[model samples]
Target: MKKILYILVLGGLMSCQKEKETVLKEDIQFLKIKNGLIESSYYENVESIKPIDGFIPNDSTAIRIAETILYKVYGENNIVKQRPYNIALKQDSIWCIQGNLPEGWEGGVFYIELNKNNGKVEKMFHDK
Candidate 1:
């Protein structure tokens, strides 16, 4: 029993140690130059989501980057709409935020605030 308890404790610690992603304010490129995955879509999920982009970022590729961070924080299907807002590459890397969501038919609304300096975001809570 003691050994089992020890293993359980270790597992808990390991699972809780989810590494956070850090996005620099100056290193964000809207388009993926490495794999040439620009103008891609998350057709697997998230429907009715119209294509949205901005100037300087012809395709708002920053959204994909932001979505990656959000997915890490809140497992799949948590972020429903990952849209970019206020995308401007002025001197510093563009700073933007997106909305996330829970499972199906959730009337409740949720939003995620972006922290470009660290490239991570926490779920913003509001009273229903």
Candidate 2:
């Protein structure tokens, strides 16, 4: 009787394992199909999309782009400390962004100059 009980338990465990494997395979196949559909749809519609007027159209756009790069190169905390950034347009097509220090603070800030029309980074440096 004990041997028979052990055989039954082992069989149940094997069946459960097989069920899990089947579910996993189904999930993987579903993900593959969904991914393929999304990719194909994007490619078909991408060419019809209109081009943007300018890569860095405004001051806010320039700031967002600068912050993204700054966060990656410098730590988030370090970059956030230098708020109230100074932004200017040079030659009507270049964005000049510089980080600012708080009152009475004395330290070098990050500076980035890029082309507003094409979104090209012409110069980037952090003052020491």
Model 1 is weakest, by summed lDDT over 10 consecutive residues, at 18-27
How does residue 55 of candidate 2 score in lDDT?
83
Q: Quantify all predictions' global Cα lDDT against the true fold.
A: 0.46, 0.85
Judge candidate 2 at residue 74 and give its lDDT: 82
TM-score of each: 0.29, 0.59
Tell me model 1's lDDT, rounded to 2 decimals: 0.46
> How do the residues 57-114 of candidate 1 rate in per-residue lDDT, one tens digit apiece?
4324555665566567665465544232334433343444535343464444334444
lDDT of 2 by residue, 1-128 (tens): 99999999999999999999999997666456563364353355455533375689899999999999988998788788888899999998899999999989988899999788788899999997
TM-score of 2: 0.59
